[model samples]
Target: MKVLTANRLSDGIAVWYADGGWAETVTRADIAHDKAAEDRLEAIGAAAAANNEVVDVN
Candidate 1:
C-alpha cells in the first residue's frame, strides 16, 4: 500500500492524505493499492504543495 504525505502549511505538522483530504497522522491516511491511484493522490497533493499548503508531498 501507499499514501500521500506532507506538512500542514499553518504549522508544518506532518500530515497524510485521508478520506479525500489531508490528516495529521498516517493512521488516517487513505490507502492506495496501485500506481495509478497513487499518482492521482499525488496530483491532488501537488496542488496543496503549489499553494504552499504543504511541502515535500510523496
Candidate 2:
C-alpha cells in the first residue's frame, strides 16, 4: 500500500510523498492552488486509514 503526503517546509516549500518516502521537494511557486488535489489526497488518506484500522481490528 502507498500513501501521499504533503508537507510545508520552513522555506515555504511544499513536498509530496509517494510510494517511498518523499518523492521530491517542490517550491510553492511550482504548484498552483488546486482544490481537487486536496480533495483527492484527503480521499486517499481516508481510505488508507480505514484499511489500516480494519486490519488492526481483525
Candidate 3:
C-alpha cells in the first residue's frame, strides 16, 4: 500500500507525496475541482493532520 499526502498549491493544484517523497502533482483542472474530490482530499488531510501519518489506501 502506498501512503499519500496532498498539499494544496497557491494555484489551486494539489501535489501528492508519499513517505515524504514526491508522488505526483494534480491540478484542480485535472479533477475538475469536483466536490467529491475536494471532500475526499480534505478528509485525508484531516486524518493526516490529526495523526501525523500519511493516508494509505490500497
**Tens-place lDDT digits, model 1, residues 1-58:** 8989998888988899898788987898888899999888978898989988888788
Q: Which ten residues in a row have the lowest lDDT in candidate 3?
A: 23-32
Q: What TM-score does model 3 achieve against the real structure?
A: 0.39
- State TM-scores per candidate: 0.87, 0.39, 0.39
- Report the poorest 10 consecutive residues by lDDT, candidate 1: 17-26
Residue pairs of candidate 1 with colliding backbone atoms: none
Model 3 clashes, total count: 0
Off by over 4 Å in 2: 1-33, 53-58
What are the runs in model 3 whose C-alpha is more than 4 Å off? 1-32, 54-58
- Model 2, 1-58: lDDT tens digits are 2235443333333345444233344322122247775565556555544654211110
Candidate 1 wrong stretches, greater than 4 Å: none
Instruction: Report the number of the highest-lDDT candidate.
Output: 1
Q: lDDT for every model?
A: 0.87, 0.40, 0.44
| Error in Å for residue 56 of model 1 | 1.5
Query: Which lDDT value does model 2 have at 52?
Result: 44
Better of 2 and 3 by lDDT: 3
Report the poorest 10 consecutive residues by lDDT, candidate 2. 49-58
